[model samples]
Target: MSDNQPSPDTILRLINGYWSTGILGAAAAHDLFTHLEAGADSAAQLARRAQISERGAQTLLDGLVSVGLIDLAGGRYRNTAAASQYLVAGRPADLSALARLKLTHMGNLTALPEVVRAGGPVTDAAVEVADNPHWGQVVPAIAAQSVPAAAVAADVLQLERAGEISILDVGGGSGIYSATWLERNPAARATQLDWEPINAIARRLLAERGLADRFTCIDGDFHTTDFGTGTYDIALYSHIAHQEGPEDNIAVFTRLKDALKPGGALLVVDYVVDDDRAGPAFPLLFASEMLLKSKQGGTWRRADYHAWLTKAGFSDVSFHAAPPATLVIAR
Candidate 1:
């Protein structure tokens, strides 16, 4: 390759890089994209609007321009097309929450070396829900994502055919999955179970959506709580299983199976790795994040889920691909 051309390894590392994390965090915190949304402004004007030092704002603006996140013209700064569309607050595609999530976890990155040295034990001291107020915020955001994911899963499951469908949303914060199902299927009602603080948020969210009348909230630890018995037709364990180890996961699914009526469907939505555990960037990166953040953080394979479902007495196990992840459904 020519000297001017970037090496394949260098390009790969850049593609998978975390180098721009701080810049993204700074932009989010300063609301730079939001400021630019009104129209182009000088760095000094942006600094005043964002309430930051002018010199610092100029430096940041120039950096963003260098990265093609913004455009520079006549000593003024403006959001690039990409940033204007996706990073500006109130825009439909705004990813401010995602950016904030990165900022919140930035401190945890420092512990990764220590975690590797100690075989991942350092994550035991990683920020937990009790330690971080922002942790609760993730529940609602996750709910926004899960509700649709579950709906897709439900559609695939042919939930409308079932009579008197009862759904148990395990670790179902914000009750979005349950709420979505209830909205679509008037014959169906749901029970959302999650931690007390998160469940409180779920209750408020459900009420805001006028879904409190249709959904029930069970506030308790999923691992210890009795999730009721033989009442549910669809049991959903969305985006929670991979946080615990395989044995604990099996236990949870077994509990769900026991709680289900005969021939009931069990829906498991998560970032599933290939059985070979070799590739696909997001899940692998998520598994690494779990390693640095959760006690039992890693992506499980479809085979792993199938094995657990089979062991839990759930039959007709099937897997479906969703963007960024997969759904494992069993009955």
Candidate 2:
């Protein structure tokens, strides 16, 4: 390469620097986009609204403007199109809560050094020390995101004719999957199995959705729990399989198959990696985060899921895309 040209690796690293996250988090914490939704404001105005020092607001706003998250005209800052659409509070596409969750709870990026030193999955020591209900507290937030996925999965699973149908939601935090399905199909009943603390959250969520009458929350570990045999018309294994290794995932699927009627369907929703394991940066990056936090959690390819489903005695295994992630349906 010529002296004037930057190396591809160097360019990539520069583009993906940690500063991006800091800037995004700062913008979210200040609610900068929300304030700018109506119109632009000067740094002093923004500082007053955000209750931060003028200098601090100016510095953060400058960075945001540089990153194209905000626009500056006549020394007043306004949200960029992308920020206005996705970062502003009260908007349909708002992802501010998700951003805040990442910044406050996950803390994966900040724990990288310790994770590397330990050569193992990083535990949330702060939460553990405080006896914090990490999974319980996050269940509501997870359920909010899962609502759409559940609806899509239910549609694809085709659980319409319901007559005392049994449905198992393995690792189904907050009972979103079962709640959604039960809400649509009144005659169907569901069993949501998850950690004890998370089961409390699931109960609360089901009650909130007026689904408590049709859904039962079971507090237990799926790995050790007996999911029963040939009882369910539909089994949903959404967003939990990737947190395990292939062997464990296959075992879970096999168990799910045994729990389902001969013609019943198993619905799985997760980030499915392409065969090459290249591009689609979000899923791959999520897999890395899983690696950093779990003993054997990572994203899997569609082919891998299909193969496992077939081996688990489910024929007609297939994959369907649900916007960001893929849904694997088998019967």
Q: Per-model C-alpha lDDT, please?
A: 0.77, 0.78
Per-residue accuracy of model 2 over 213-296 as CA lDDT, tens digit each: 888877777888998998888888888878788989999999999999878888889988999998467788777666676777
Q: Which pairs clash in model 1?
A: none
Candidate 2 has what TM-score? 0.80
- What RMSD, rounded to one decimal, does every model reach? 4.1, 4.0
Candidate 2, lDDT over the whole model: 0.78
- The 10-residue segment of model 1 with minimum total lDDT is 123-132
